[model samples]
Target chain A: MDLLPFFQQLEATTVGRVVRESLWMFPVIECVHLLALALLGGAVLLVDLRLLGFGLVNQPVDLLARKADPWLLAAWMVIIATGIPMFLSEATKCYYSPPFFYKIGLLVIASVYTFTYRRRVTRELAYGRAPLTACASLALWFGVGFAGRWIAFY
Target chain B: MNFSAFVQWLDATPGSVALRESMLGYPMIETMHVLTLCLFLGMIALVDLRLLGLGFQSIPVSEVAGRLLPIGLAGFVLMAVSGALLFYSGPIRAYGNIFFRIKMALIMLTGINALVFHYTIYKRVASWDRDPIPPLRARLAGLCSLVLWSAVVVCGRMQAYNWFEKAPGA
Candidate 1:
């Protein structure tokens, strides 16, 4: 299905129009998005670092993950919430933007892998695969962040 | 030389001109700068949160600081290098930006806060390192760091909008 038509329609919605029309609105939302990104990035970094045997050496992987969980969840919630309006305001542009697609693709994979595979591996204390998992996790998440930034330039 | 003249001279340098004019240079540096924030601010926030007794209550404060400090320091190095490149790319613009001024002030304040905490309260970590709730001074330091760093981020982000620039032909 050609999703361009749907995206165009979505951009016509009231929320989209408001966000797009107001000069300050988009920037304000972007600031919030970035703040949440810091928190989420921090949470992800700590867990991934621990798994890689870098820092937090004495703390158990599962315990550190558990401690960082609330922050991760809260930050993700804010990021998604802020991200939606940003997408809506420029849905059609995003549809045409390759970086937008790349960002979304990376975001989905990162989220799934983080919660499922990474979580299980940490819980199981799979030391052998921990480094690889940590590397993959960082690459995927940072890939998302990079592509997200590229959307503007694209 | 005066500060403004220095900024103007720096902005006019060949390297700065190339960075600003290059299709990839500015954006790449900017992307690196933004990406590293997660690492830099993230670690700092964790330590700050612990100091404030907000999170990671089970771990001793010293361990939290010791282990994470290295990572945070590494992130800080990246942040600083990329940040300097960004400033080098457009010194005049940054020098004039109100948000940039605020960000600089906040960063300096954060540095002072960290130094004070380390020398005064943090020197006695053995006394309160085991306590989930740190001493009042330590907690105050954490609170200040959180607030100042957050403001720094806000100002840093806002610097991009050109909100303070005079409207053309006004």
Candidate 2:
């Protein structure tokens, strides 16, 4: 189904108007969004490194991943909160952007991988290894970031 | 001998020419630069926040720093390589960019702040390594790192926008 109508309605809201009309506000939100993206990407990669048999080896892989999980999740929350207003402000532009869709797709795949197979494998490191999963996780999340950045290029 | 001459030489370099002319090379390098930056910030925030008494209190600051350092260093190394490539791709424009100048200045300030911390209170960190609230200087160092890096990220991000423009010379 077409989503432009929903985007249009959201953009008509007071918050959306402020986000769209105020030059500084959009940039401010953008700054927050970008920082959150970086934090999230970093946190995720740190955990991924553990899965790849590197980084944070002083502690158990599970512990490292668990400890870093909160920051990863917190940054994700901030990104989503800040992102919505920016998206609402330029809903149509984003809706038409290919890279935006790529970002979303990669985000979904990365999150799923994080919550499922990646978590299981890291939890049970004795049962063989999942270096391929680690590699894919890195590519997927970083891909989301790259695609998100690409949205601005267009 | 002069900065302009150096920039001119860089612009004429073969690798730089390919970076600018290739369809995917510049974008791919830019992507890596940004992603590495994100990873670096993430690792920095973990240690800095603990020092600032904000987050991750369960673990000792030293342990947190120890664990994240290698990954952070890797990110920094990769970013340096990608960043040099980016600047080399368009030496004149990068040198002329106001935001690029701010970014460099902030990076220098951050380096100095870290150096001072390492040389001073951080050397005697054993006593307060596990303290929930760090000593005044340690807290100040952490606060400075956060603010300085925040500014650096903003300046770096803004470099791609309108504030950057090409000058006739470097």
Candidate 3:
């Protein structure tokens, strides 16, 4: 589709103007983005490993999940918050980049898994092992991270 | 060789040359570096929070640490390898960076803190494993590690930009 005008319009906005004009703003936001990703991914993988029966097997699943879940949600919020301004600054470039779409797609899939399959599967300890859900979570989240880095290259 | 000489050597090494030259080499290694942090930092957080009596209190501290150590170490190994490749690919910028030095220092200090915890206070873990609140030393180590690791993350991220790039022989 010829949606280039929409992205160009976004780049003309005040928020986009600030991000593009200020040399330090982009890298500052990027640093925060990476830090938030570290926290979010770390929390997600820790819980997923337990779900896969790899680590923390003998521990109560819900208890550990409870501890990590807060950090995960908070960091997710930060990632989006920081990511938006960066995307807006270079809206046209990101819109045309294949890796940006790939990253967004994986992020959506991973978020769905987190809210649905993961939540249900890890809800009760008596559900035995659900390696499939755990595996999917790992793959989806890691895929999002990988694609995010690829945005810089491709 | 001096520091610059060592860095020059790393930059010229065959593997480093390939990583720097190949289009996908740097990004791929960076992807692995970020991915591995999930295991290294994520696994440690679970056990550290337990030691601090903030998480997984229902489980014994030793068990939490015991189960998570292997996986965390595996992540650390992968992280170190990938991190080395990243550094080797662009040693000039990396070596002159202040944040890089801070990250290295934090890594060394955090490692020593872990070693001390393991050999000493952790030896008496049996007595306090289920205490809900671990011994003062164990909790101190946990807190220190968490803070240090977080700082390292920020430093590593900051080093991505050239904010601290110095002048030539100034």
lDDT of each structure? 0.92, 0.81, 0.84
- Which residue pairs in candidate 3 have backbone atoms (N, alpha carbon, C) closer than 3 angstroms, thus clashing? none
Clashing pairs in 2: none
Candidate 3 lDDT over A40-62, as tens digits, reads 87788767887777777776677
Expressed as tens digits, the lDDT of each residue in B50-158 for candidate 3 is: 8888876778888889988888899899999999889988897788889999999999999999999999999988889899889899999999988888788878878
Better of 2 and 3 by DockQ: 3
- Report the lDDT tens digits of candidate 2 across residue range B82-167: 99889999997788788899899999999999899989998988999889988999889989988998898888778776523533
User: Where does candidate 1 stray beyond 4 Å?
Assistant: A126-129
Mark the 10 consecutive residues where model 1 chain B has the least summed lDDT: B161-170
Residue-wise C-alpha lDDT for candidate 1, range A1-154, written one tens digit per residue: 9999999999999999999999999988998899899999999999898878887978888888888989999999999999999999999999999999999999999999988998888777733337898999999999999999999888
In order, the candidates keep a fraction of the true contacts of 0.85, 0.66, 0.66
TM-score of the A chain in model 3: 0.93
DockQ of each: 0.86, 0.59, 0.62
TM-score of 3: 0.90
By lDDT, rank the candidates, best first: 1, 3, 2
Model 1, C-alpha of A124: deviation from truth (Å): 1.8
Per residue, candidate 2 scores C-alpha lDDT tens digits across A4-73 of 8987888788888888898578877888887888778777776677667765656566666676778888
- Expressed as tens digits, the lDDT of each residue in B85-164 for candidate 1 is 99999999999999999999889999999999989998999989889899899999999998898888889889988767
